[model samples]
Target chain A: DQQVKQNSPSLSVQEGRISILNCDYTNSMFDYFLWYKKYPAEGPTFLISISSIKDKNEDGRFTVFLNKSAKHLSLHIVPSQPGDSAVYFCAASTPGYALNFGKGTSLLVTP
Target chain B: DTAVSQTPKYLVTQMGNDKSIKCEQNLGHDTMYWYKQDSKKFLKIMFSYNNKELIINETVPNRFSPKSPDKAHLNLHINSLELGDSAVYFCASSQDPSGRVGDTQYFGPGTRLTVL
Candidate 1:
């Protein structure tokens, strides 16, 4: 069973605009969420993370919002640049060690 | 310098063959993990080790085994490989379990295994 799900397989946005990617989870035990950006043939790089204690976390042009009640989280990138085009993965983990990841969403930023 | 590194970036083999993938981490973390990414790009944890001790072993098949000789190394050995085992395997390391102050995982570039 897939505990974490990314409904959208792909997304496209214009440069200098905003891009939003959504993720949902069925496991209530997950308290920490993270987003990673991956380029072709490269490893997934950590982007931003949010703890269950907080509803939102921001880093530069990236922002992540979490809604514990709905078990939903979203990653937003404002003024998206061409360099932001890549596959974004959403991962969640409990207090334990293992992490559950979504299927990932491919983002394309048009110049 | 690579924080996490995996050898044999690409491996292609026939079914029923046995192979191994080696991983090393230089971050001096106490915990390490193995994750598999299928064709759909869904990453799943297969095993976890803390201080060279096995901690979490997911529902992986018995054909797959993880060996950690030291805290800095974790290697995966697959026996009688099948076509379904083709995927990209990644190695990660963290400070420790329990989600303490420092538990952020660093991932490797990943090894793509293709079983024919």
Candidate 2:
């Protein structure tokens, strides 16, 4: 069973615009949520993360919001650049357990 | 310098063959993990080693084995490769996983293995 799910398989946005990626999880035990960006052949790189204690966290152009009641989270990239085009994965983990990753969403930023 | 590095970026072998992928991390982290990404782009953890000791072992097939010679290196050895073994394997490391601090796992470039 998939505990974490990225409903959207792909997304497209114009350059300098906002791009929003959504994620949902079933396991309520997950307290840590994170996002990773991946290129065509490279490994997934950590982007942003949000703890269950907080509702939101931001890093530069990236922002992540978490809604514990809804078991939902989102990653927002403002002013999306061409370099931001890549697959984004949503992962969640309990305190010490292995992370459960979503299928990933492929985002394309058009120039 | 690569913080985490893996050997044999791409491996193509026939069925029933045995192959091993080597991974090394220079960050001096005590925890290392191996994750596999299937064709559908689903990433799943296969094994984790902390201080050269097994911490988490997922319900992966018995054909797959993970070895950690030291805290700095973790290797994956597969016996009797099958078509289902074709996927991208990623190695990651973190400072600690005691849950005291939210750990960030740094990943390697990845190794693409193809079983023909």
Q: Which is the leading candidate under DockQ?
A: 2
Tens digit per residue, CA lDDT, model 2, B40-89: 88999999999999999899898999999999999999999999999999
Question: Candidate 1, clashing residue pairs?
Answer: none
The CAPRI category of model 1 is medium
lDDT score at residue A98, model 1, on the 0-100 scale: 79
Where is model 2 more than 4 Å wrong at Cα? B98-102
Cα error, residue B64 of model 2, in Å, equals: 0.9
Could you tell me how far off, in angstroms, the CA of residue A13 lies in candidate 2 after the best superposition?
0.1
lDDT of each: 0.92, 0.92
For candidate 2, what is the DockQ-based docking class? medium
